[model samples]
Target: MSLKIAVCIKPVPDPDYYDQITIDPVRKTITRAGIPTIINPVDKNALEAALQIKEQVGGTVTVITMAPPNGEESLREMLAMGADEACLLTDRAFGGADTLATSYTLAQGLKKLGNFDLVFTGTESADGATSQVPSQLAEWLGMAHLWNVSEIKLKEDQAEDKVQELQAKMKIENGYIEYEVKLPAVLAVSRDLNTPRFTSIMGVMKAKKKPLTVFTVNDVDVDRTLIGLDGSPTKAGAVFTPSLSRKGERLTGDLDEVVEQLLQKLRAAGINLEIKSSSQGGR
Candidate 1:
């Protein structure tokens, strides 16, 4: 049986150029006007998992991203990583989306792609680091979902007519939990799952021939009110650059005097405190 797999990828500002990234105070969104982007780190892990599965199960891997036209380079990189096809959902309306709105848009894009036996995503995006999209997207699709996956195993029955199942180890705070799930599931893969394969010259050459479709809100069916900043419930109250300058004051005296001086400084800094007097100065 041939499987259809979709990997959700994100284009993040390259770490090398992080100094160029800024926040748009008016919109409360990331300003990437000039900053270059690359495939998000953990997202490559998810794509690698999808590619490995496609190699083993005789399937096609489709990589999808919701970003601006500038993200085309990131998609091309994924194609070079062996994805058969790529899709980019880009629209001015998608700006300033919170996790909920973002996931809703991505879910609509996935719906446009038809059916998929499995979906892969990074455990969290580098910029947002919310770790919410995976479960939200699974909810939107009404599919079983798992996150922080450490390992994946495929099992097929011995009978001529067989069913394939997947068992995976999921990382937890204390250790790991094992789960066996049926097909058509979603996974938020951990970076520890696998090391992504490097793109070779041959892969790059082949990637040029692959299809990369770009879509807007007009192409995919989506609720305009539920896909951007306007629909998002959580809003940024204040966005500003923090001052990095520091001031230091030296305290000199015995331990008790130093402790008393520090407490005075804290109180002066607006920290409310109530003290009970110690008789005879005994602490």
Candidate 2:
């Protein structure tokens, strides 16, 4: 049976420019106005996993994301990595969304896209690292979900054009646990699951001809009260950089006296220091 797989991806600020990222003082939100972006690293792993499955079985891999219009670049890159199609959900209304609102918007986008046998996502985004979207999306879709997946094995169904089950390994602290997951499921994959392939000249050329569609809040059927910042329950409390200044002291005295003063200062600061008896060694 042929499968229809969807991989959810995100565009995050480039790590090289992390030092330049800042928070908006008034809104208490990440200020990403001028920062360059890249497809979140672990999200590439999720796309790779989806592509592998499509190769093992006859299937179509579609990449989806909720980001700014510039997110089209990330989607094009995914198409070069072998996704059959790409979808971008973008709008000013989507601004300042937390994981819950983001997931809800993505779920609505998926519904409009069509039914899928599976959906894959990275364990977390590089910037947020909340590890919440996959489970939250599953809840919105009312589907089974799993996270930290490092391995997968697909099981064929007797019925034509359908998938019923598969085995997946969830990476844990000490080891990994294997589970038989039923289809039409959401999986948040870890980076260790697979190594992503580089985009080749041919793949890049092919990607140029692939369909990359953009949708906005008006296109998808979504609740106005549950699709953006207004729907986000969590908000940033306080955002500020801590002071990194240091204090120093210099002792002015003869060598022995200076050493004693240093020792006393160290002791005053709760440091444990013991001087051995010098008479035994005649120091």
Clashes of each: 0, 0
Q: Pick by TM-score: which candidate is best?
A: 2
Candidate 1 residue-wise lDDT, 207-244, digit = tens: 99999999998999998999889868789776666677
For each candidate, what TM-score against the reference? 0.80, 0.83
Clashing pairs in 1: none
For all candidates in order, the CA lDDT equals 0.87, 0.91
Candidate 2 per-residue lDDT, tens place, 31-107, comes to: 77878789999999999999988888878999999998999999999999899999999999988899999999999
lDDT of 2 at 267: 96
Best by lDDT: 2
